[model samples]
Every structure is written in C-alpha cells, then in structure tokens.
Target: MPIDQLVTLLENESIREALMIVYERSDGGTEELEWRDVRDALSSEQWGTLIEQEVLVSAGSGFAIAEPGRVERLLGGDDPSEDAGTDGIESPSWTTADKAAGAFALLLFAGYWNTGIRDIVASVESAIFGPVAGLVPFHLVIVFLAVVTGFYSTVLQSRLLDREKLEQYKQRMTDLQERTAAAKERGDEEALERLQEERMAAAGDQLGMFKLQFRPMVWIMLLTIPVFLWLRWKVRGGHLGTGETGLVVPIAGAVTWQQSLVGPMQTWLVWYFCCSMAARQLIQKVFGLRTGTSS
Candidate 1:
C-alpha cells in the first residue's frame, strides 16, 4: 500500500519543520538542497526520515523535493490534530528459522563434552567422509574440512548481514558523539543533557548490533559442530592407523594429533584453526567477499 503522504508529512513536528526549511532553502522546490545548508536547523533523525520516506530524492549534488505539488498542498492544509510519537531505533528481530537454527546449534555444541552425542554424530558422518579418509592422511582431511567450512562461513556472513542497516546505526552513533563533544566544549549543559537522553535511548542499538553479528555465527556453528565432532571421534576412537596420527607443525615440529600443544588445545585443533583462518582470508580476498561493515 502507498504511504499516506500528507499524514506522514504533517504528523511529526520535527519532520514538518525540517520540510519547511528544505523548501525555503531549495527556493520552493525549484532547486536542490544539501545537508550543509540545513544541518544546523535539522537533526539527523529528521534528515534520515526525509530520505527514508522518499520525500527528498537524489538530485545530482544533493536532494530535491520528490513531489513539489503534493508537498505544497499538504503544507497549505490544516495541521494534524494527533501528534506522532517519537521514532525510536528499530532493532531487527530474529525470525523463527533463526531461533530454530540457534537452538539446534546449542544442542550440537553439547556433543563436544558428551561422548554419546559425539559418537552418534561421528558414526553418521563417517559414512560420508570414510571413503575420503581412506585415500588421504588425516591431517589433509583436517585441512579439507577447514577450507570447506571457512568458505561457507564467509559466504553465509556476507549474505546474512545487513550492511546498510549496520552503517546507519554507526552513522547515528557517530553523529551523536560529535554533537555531544561540541556541546561539552561550549559548556552547554542543556544540550548536553538532551544528548545524554538520546544516548541512553540509543543504548539498545548496541544490543541490536550484537544480534546482527551473532545471527550468522549461530548458523556457522550449526554446520561446523558436526565436522568437529567427527574429527574428535576419529582422533580419540583409534581410527588413525600407525603413522596417520602424527603431523609436523610450525615451531612445534612433529606432534601427534592428540598431543596438547597450547594449554588444553590439542595439535589437531590448533592446526585446524590455523588452516581455517588462512583459508577464510584467502577466500575473502580472491572472491571480494566482505564480512565487515562498509566504510
């Protein structure tokens, strides 16, 4: 359904004032207006709303009124009696699928400590990897698993995350910080107090950011845990015959897969992580995959 443009423009006092400012500065919609022209008169929220609502459209160097005739008509009419509530930061909610995946991931995590779960997962996975294990050394199998997991993990994160929304959250926080610092420098207690209130409200955005970061991790874990359990079973269940268990690693020289190299971390786990990190980095560079927020 189309937005009730008149209601949207007239409902919020800040948006109405900002629209008037833009109209005057743009010479009654004949010209375009840039942020610098009205930055002092309008807040970031107001400016964001104008762009989001499609009231201001991209016009070369800046923005112009999307529908000058409709804006003129709305401005000339009586104000809306019901004032709109203040807009809060909209945090993304997890879908039912995401929750389900997270639950399964947690259950899979228990396989690391529980021998019953570990054995079951390993037995199931052996049917798939047993043929390959027969052809290559166990260390090569670890390398192959690491590379496969790394590729999918990187792709999943790039596809699942909302870079634009994360950027918006960052921009809002940066704007607030800059304004707060300026208010402090000028010793404006009133502006400082107001910015503090805005900061408190924005605290929820941090949790939202965390949620966005962790959503992909749940899926990654769900896929990775089974592989890990299978590897653990292979190492501990005496599946490795004679020389297959030993691997030569950097600094540590020759070490058995079961040998503890770093604190409680065994040789296989350490080797797996090193291979995974290198493969993930190489895959990202080769494919131009982005996992971090854009600048």
Candidate 2:
C-alpha cells in the first residue's frame, strides 16, 4: 500500500480503535476474533474500509491478524516468534547496565551543555557573524544550532531505527501487495483476501518503522529545549532583544516585520523553520544518512 493511503487508514478513529480491540482480544497470540469483538469500536464505514483495504479478512468464520507475525512485531509483542525477519542481536531490549549507562550519558550531556556548550556556541556565532544586532548574532547562532541538531538527530535516527531493517519491511510489504493484486486479477477471491490481510500487516510494520524513526526526536528534545532556553537567554539584550522578529536569509539579507507563508508570524521563527528543513536535508545527504527505501 502507498504510505498516504495507509496513513489515512490508520488515522481513522474507528479503525484505530477496532485494531486496538482486536489486539487486546488476541492477547498477542494466534487467537481469532469475531466481528463482535470490535463491532462496538468500529462503525460500518470503518469496517468496510478495513475490508476493502485488506486490513481485515474472513478467517474460519471469524477474523485473525492479516499477518500475525508482522502485526505482532509492529505492535512490539514480546514473543520472538512474531517476527522472523528480526534478529535477536538487532533488538532494542537493553540490559540494566545499558539503561544505567544511558542515564549517566544523558546527565553528563545536560551538565556539559549547561556549563560550557552555551558559551562556546555563542562565541563561535559571534566570531563568525560579528554580532548581527542582538547581544550575540541571533540568526547565526540559531542556524548553527539547527545544523548541529540536524546532524545529531539524523545520526540518532539511523542508529536507533535500523534503516536496512525498515527497508526490508517495506520490501516485504511491496511484495505482498503485488501478490494481492495478482490474486485479484486471477479471480482468486480467497487468495486475494488473504493477501490483502497480509498487506495490511505490512502497513502495520511501516507504521512501526515510522514510530521508531520519530522516537529519537523526542529523546533529542530533552536536550534541545534546555539548549534553546540558554540561547534565548544569551540573545536577550540590545536593540534586537528576544522580542524582535526578522527574516534572515544567510548570505542574502534580513528583513524585520516581513510576511511569511503564514502572514504576520514571527519572521525569525519562520526563518528558523525554513533554514532547519533545508539544513536537515543537506546534512543528511552529506553524512550519507539518506536511507532510500526506508525514508
């Protein structure tokens, strides 16, 4: 299934609820569930969509997970048998020592940033840009931070999400979808239905991959927020102050009180977003962080 279609299916409240109900009743096992298990949670339209989308299919007078192994793995089920594609060594399950080490590392990062990184970043910004109005160069500092954050975020995502693994999941989904289409063309309704269910399971795996990819950002924000606060504090003075809003295009120019895509928003904020988005792509490419199929 295309990502957009899968996203639309997953976004439906009733469908989401129905999936949850089915998952609960199945107890992460092979137990089949009748429509009665999810009927209350799903509307007729939702049920129809699930069937049409191959997210649900008839099985022995009831319904079972389209691809139990894939679905189970996507849902992060504890059972190892749920995902044959996954290797034990590639799992994210951390030992107690690993958890302790991670905690210590985060604490150290926080302390280091609060104590020295702020001053160093500010100094570097000033040395490069020569103070573009505020206590320090606001745009320059933010842009630098944006690049730093982008590089680190990409690294974290690559390490944590396992791009190659996600690519394999996507490939499996594509193969299943092709098989489903072939079955439908050959008038094999039973095969088609089964294939559709399997395709849906692949969709679940795609969703899981997305979740894992984004999880690193949340963890990164734990450090990002404090660093942003420090930067804000450092930039609070002179004519520009923190209240001043402006559009800054590197090597071009800056304009205060200018309109952006959303009219009348803070120019600096808009500029930050624009710069961040562009910089992330550039950094990702430069670092060879572009995971073709996975992304």
Candidate 3:
C-alpha cells in the first residue's frame, strides 16, 4: 500500500474475465486495477484488541485491498499470433460438438413436422408401397433438426462473444476506479492526467479490437440452410408432410424419418447445453467468476 493510497470498496463481478476492480488512493498517479484477486485481499478488522486500546485515527474504513489480475486462463495470454483453426480445444465461441448436436436434434423435429405434412401422400402411397412411404417420414425429421441446429449454433457463438463484451465492461470499470482513486490522492491536476491516460489507452485498445471481429467469414453458418433441406429430402425420400395429421406432426411439414431419431436428437441437445454450463463452471473455478446466485 502506498503511504498516500488506501484501499476502498470492491466492485461486483463481471462476465468471463478474471480481473476485478478495487478502489484505492495514490499520490495522484493512475491506480487502475483490473483483477480477479479482490476476494483474497478483502479482510475484516473489527476484532483488533491491541490497536483498539489506543485512540483510533479517522483513517476511513479499513479493509483488505484488491489486486488486478485475469479471471480466466484462456492460454492465448494476450497473444495475437496463433492459427485460426482451433483443433482439440473448443473456440470458446463455437465448437463442432455443439453444431453436430444441435443439427441432429433439429433434424428430428423437422422429421416429425414433415411426417404430418406428408400424411396425405403417405396414405395415398400406403396402398402401393408401405415401406417406401416411410422414407418420406424421415425427411421431415432431418429438416427440423437441421434448422434447430443452425439456429442454436449461432446462439452459442453469440453468447461466447457476449462474455467477451462483459469482460471489456469490467475492465473499463477498473480503469475508471483507478482514475477516481488518483484524483482522490492528487487533487485536480494530476487526476486529469490519470483520466487522460485512461482515455488514450481505451482509444488504442478500440483500434486494435476492430480488426478481430468474427463475422462475415465463417462459412459454416451459411452452410446450415442447404444442409437442413438436404437432410429433409434424404429422410422423406420425396413426400413432404402436411398439417392434417395432428397426431404425427402436429405442426405443418411434420417429418417422419424414424421415431427413434427423436430420442437421440433430444439427448444430444441436452449434452450440448451441458457443455455451455460446463464452460461457466470452468470459468468460475479457474478465474473466480462469480454467478448470479453467489458472490
């Protein structure tokens, strides 16, 4: 602790980043701290008997100090040199597993919808070829799965990016704190310098970030619609389901590839969802990311 600066209150948790912010005073210099180690620094001094006997100084509220550090171990370590193709490790944004799972589940729902849509065709063809009619049922299922898969694939990626945004917000809060602290310690002039320092840093950071956007080049997302349609066709053979068959495909375009596919798709979605939950857990465990229900 600088003789001029003393620790103040701690800010609440933000998404993803490990670093947290703490309030402290300094001799008018910048004291911005973006860290995740605040909890370790915070302490209660209510039970000090030895110092209690003497006259207490009005030194404001005394508490444990906080530090600036990362909350997550993303391994990239502020590095800009790396292959874009993330093989074994999931891209914190998108994963093949997530794409596969969502695609399959949506396929099943599409099949169900297709089944009902082509019921009339099924009934018409049932007399001639019962087995062949069944083929049409599968297409509906595949289409549903494909649509859902694509939608959720993007959803997952968006969420991951959202975490990054929150992390930036948390960093900003920290910078603001440090500037405020410097102002407290150095009166008006030095505080202005601290604020200017923060502005320059932020301006520079923004320029670099503009080039790292993850859109307009990921071909996988564009491939989803056609893939979904193809799957539907493959499952149904040729016939598309209709809305008349309330029992099979309650909705229009009820796909009916195989009743069994539904189970697998549902299971896969559950698993992918679990993956996101696991990511949250990992962040919390490693970088001390706090949750809504907890501190």
Candidate 4:
C-alpha cells in the first residue's frame, strides 16, 4: 500500500483508535492480531476497513500489519516518503578552498585564447619544466606531462568524490524506478501517482550528482592548463629543434607537432590526449582507484 493512503486511513478517528488498540495489543505489531483481541476497543466496521484496505493481511491464524516498520514509523509521526532520494544524503557544498580553486581555474582558462596571459603562464611554467625539456625530445616531454596529469587527476577524483553517497543516490533512484514499474504493472493508480510525485521531488538529485562529478575538475584544470600553455609556447616560440618538431605517430605516421590531425586539434594535442587516456587507465588498474560509482 502507498504511504499516502496509509496516511489517509490514519486521519479517521475511529480507524486511528482501532489501529492504536491493535498495535498495543500486538506488542508493536510483533504478533498477529485477531479481531477478538481488540473487540472491546475496535468496532466491526473499523476492523473490516483495515482488512479491506489490505493494511492487515492474514497470518497463519490471525491478521498482522502488512508492513510493520512502515506502520510503526507512521504511527511515530515520521514520514518516510518525505525527501525520498535525499533522505540521508547531505547536499554537497563547495568549501572556500574549492571556490578559490574554481576561480583560479577560470582565470587560467583565459590563457588558452589570450596571448599575453598565455605568454606569462608559459614563461612561469618554463622555468620549472624547461630543464626537463632540454634533456628529452618534445614528444617524450608531452608523454611525461600526460602521465603526471593523469595520475593527479585520478587521485583528485578518488579523494574528492563521495563514492558511497553517489552509489546511495543512484540506488535510491533505481529502487524508485523499479517500484514505479511494479505499480504500473499492477495497475495501482494511487501508488503510481505517489511514486510519480516522489520522482519529481527527487529531481534535485541531478544537480547534486553534477556537483559531485565536477568538484575535482576545477583542481584538474588549474594544474593542467599551465603545462598546456608551456607546450604551446615551445611549439610556437621555435623552442623545438629540427628533429624534436615531429613525431612518427601510429596512424598519421610522420607528422609535425603543429600539424592539424583533426578539425582544429593539432598533432601534439592528439598525441597528448592518447597518452593521457592510456596513462589514466593504467594508473586506475594499478592502484585500484575508482572514479565512478559501481554498477
């Protein structure tokens, strides 16, 4: 039975009194309740109504509350259906550090299009990475950056994301969907309507889920954008020598770092992307880190 109907049933004075009597006599619904046991307090009509509504189903010899825990909760004045999906899950709030990181990440993102910001970031980053670049070819430098970014990205996601809470949120929605389907199959319009209302109320969970997934991205962008700027500076500022400017990649064979492999994506960016993906997968496998909720 839907909680709404159970609530409605409790509104009747006679039904409420009868339920109280039955609950008390049955030891909080631990034992079966026969009509004869509460005959003095409950009227025939109330007993018949309880049976008709299926609130009490036949046990081995007598009737018992169909769902004792639900009945107990309702009687205790708690509404289980209120905030169905967000019952135990707290809303994710961004801390001051998180907000600061996001703000800084946004500022860094401007370097991608603004030449002055790009040069400043590249100049600052080159002081740190330039020595490494001087030793290895530019392609190897790109691979090294990819591995570093991939490792940190995975670690940030694992630490920042609340995997258990995410799983709970998903499981609650899945359970609601299954209940909705069952109600539809049974042609229970009242139950279906209640489930639909619950589903609508749970819609705010989508935003909560989004916040959970995006919390780590700000940190990632803050760390990654500077390395990208440095790579761009190296290519455009004639930092790469004759042999370091090109690479023999898998599909494209030999291609210059600045050559366009995809629609606006340069060869270097493509290679970095491929390397980042492979490195991320390997890191996750080796460390048993999970960035997403399990099925």
**Considering every candidate listed, which one attains the maximal lDDT?**
4
lDDT for model 2 comes to 0.56
Tens digits of per-residue lDDT for model 3, 1-295: 1111211111222211112222222111123221232334532232121123111111233322221121111212432111111121122334685456555545444543576534543344345444543555433343344445544444444443434543454455465566456344434454356456545545534433332233311333434433433433433454435531212334323333333324555322333344445544555556554332124
**Per-residue CA lDDT of candidate 2, range 1-295, in tens?**
3333544565666676666667677775356676677677667776677667765655566655554434444445344332333332243344464455456546535644475644554455446444434444566666766777667766765666556655665656665665555444445577666566655545557556665455555556654644554444343423245565655455546666343434655455565667778887997877788634444
Best by TM-score: 4
lDDT of model 1, residue 83: 12
Per-candidate TM-score against the hidden true structure:
0.70, 0.47, 0.28, 0.73
- Report the poorest 10 consecutive residues by lDDT, candidate 1: 78-87
**How does model 1 score by TM-score?**
0.70
- Looking at model 3, residue 132 earns an lDDT score of 40
Which whole-number lDDT from 0 to 100 does residue 215 have in model 2? 53
lDDT at 170, model 4: 83
Error of 4 at 219 (Å): 1.1
Model 3's TM-score against the true structure? 0.28
User: Order of candidates by lDDT, top first?
Assistant: 4, 1, 2, 3
Better of 3 and 4 by lDDT: 4
Question: Model 4, which residues run further than 4 Å from truth?
Answer: 1-85
